[model samples]
Target: MQILEEKTLGIKSWSPEDRPREKLILKGRASLSDAELIAILLGTGTATMSAVDLAKRILLCADNNINRLAQLTVKDLVKIKGVGEAKAISIIAALELGRRRKSSDADKPAITSSKLAFDVLKSDLTDIPHEEFWIMLLNRGNRVVKKQKISLGGVSGTVADPKIIFKLALDELASGIILAHNHPSGNLEASVADLDLTRKLKEGARLLDIQILDHLIIAEDRYFSFADEGLL
Candidate 1:
């Protein structure tokens, strides 16, 4: 049914089966779309809008990117017509909890697989509106020694100096390192720049006898791994 655009009646006036809260109870949480789940968080909307209508507008503010939505600040959220400070805080709090839960799921100390590396970093980098380069230092067994940020840049690209990356790895006495960087546009394809940088870093690490295990392009929910794809 048509239910939005800030002109729908209040959620309470809708059929009980159609309300977000009731839908969750009846159909299970997985059945609701992201907007509907957020509507449940909002609780109510403005005089002219249903809760789902307000939630859709909030999602629109982030271009309907849940990852990007998680990044919006309270000050940024309250700027929306129907979003007050309390509602803004609620949105931020819920997203933060999700982030923490993802991070908490990283139970292994070793970065044994590309999926593991993605799990380790996605909580912080996924859906961000900027690019960032990070390196994971690994011991001989591929257990993580530390994760270091190399650089942060705009939406399109970020720079990672091989010197700085190696220096940190060397300092940690790392035997191998995995390269990671986020693509805010949610594109997992390795750009020309991404390939060039990976080649350069691989050669540099080879000279230092430190293995470049993989270079991952971390987009939103997935990643492109050079090693996994045999590009390394």
Candidate 2:
């Protein structure tokens, strides 16, 4: 009879070097593949699948794109056969920690250019299915005082309420503001509503004595900056 390495044998029967946790400890984190790292987070597997095998299935759902995998909701993960709520939560927590670390590492203390703005914002906006509007409230020196979410919507677009925006800026005592939103379709072009909103906000900012410094349309890993294009 052929030797069975799967089923009840599980990862325990595998050679230490082949096990994700043991490999991570022996070989260091850099030596582990993406699936291996995820397998460690999963901790255990189903009756039919090993932890590594189950993690591979999860990666397949994201098409092996780490960015897309980070975007998955807890509900999206639990739908997978072997992933329970606890395992799904662990995966989400690990991804979120990595994301926050990345954002902090890319931090720009001041808002001097659109490129810097994009660098700071892309961590929050990229690799997601929905559209979200956000703003950076800046002081007189163009230093970021606060970053706030304005609204969220479906894949096509989101709404930004001028009244709420104005209230936030005024309450923060911001002297300038930068508007940004994501395009889940990966199209960076500003739609008509985007243009109209920009115009209205510019006029409102003028009345409030606040400078409308820039508007950015983020898509995927790239960004479209209105001020850079002389659209402001």
Candidate 3:
């Protein structure tokens, strides 16, 4: 009887008009907030709160950024009052599916300009807290063949060896390559090390009959392109 009482006053107690699933069906998914969509995954909540309320709490913890939420672990989600291991796993799984769909292989865009190249790889680098160097191997037509992480380092800097960069480009039979790294400091200004490395790699690529298309410095919301700045 106690269990039945608890169940009645949870999501089942809400009006059909107020239920997340019912609201979604009637009004369409675009009408729902991030919390509302997350509530659908939650299914139900503790006796003291509705699923929507629980989801709201979770989003609040992540500052309402889905990308930030994606970085969370199951333990992180379960730290909330109304969430348990099962509900946490469900949320993580749903977010991972969304990420995989966004970066699916069927949608690889070509690198026609520095901006286009920046758009292709920004999502992978922008939110990272440390330094990372990646090489985008491109075919003769400038279409991306592969994105390889060359190195990862601390907040200040990372090592990008020209020999390894050229070797990968040669192995892949790439005609061009775009170099990219993130500045966790949010500064778009290229450091002395950045400029020096770009020159060295450009020289190496020229020797191998491959083009060094650009070097991009990624920030949280913007980027600096060496090619765009006429520095490449």
Candidates arranged by lDDT, highest first: 2, 1, 3
Estimated TM-score for each candidate: 0.71, 0.85, 0.84
What's model 2's lDDT at 169?
Answer: 98
How accurate locally is residue 176 in candidate 1, as Cα lDDT from 0 to 100? 96
Candidate no. 2 TM-score? 0.85
TM-score of 1: 0.71
Which scores greater on lDDT, model 2 or model 3? 2
- In the range 1-232, model 1's lDDT, one tens digit per residue, is 9976655577788888888899899989999999899998899888888889899999999999987798899899999999999999999999999887876634457788888888787776775789999988889988878888899999999999998999999999999999999988878889899899999999999999999999888878888899899999
Window of ten residues with lowest summed lDDT in model 2: 101-110
**Each prediction's Cα lDDT score?**
0.88, 0.91, 0.86
Clashing pairs in 2: none
What is candidate 3's lDDT per residue for 120-214, written digit by digit as tens? Answer: 77767865678999989999988998888899999978999888888898899999999999998888999999999999888888888999999
lDDT tens digits, residue span 126-158, model 2: 867999999988999888888888999998989
Indicate whether candidate 1 or candidate 2 has the larger TM-score.
2
In candidate 1, the residue pairs with backbone N, CA or C atoms under 3 Å apart (3 or more residues apart, or in different chains) clash, namely none
Instruction: After superposing candidate 2 on the true structure, give the runs of residues whose Cα lies further than 4 Å from its correct spot.
Output: 1-9, 104-107
Which residue runs does candidate 3 get wrong by more than 4 Å?
1-9, 73-78
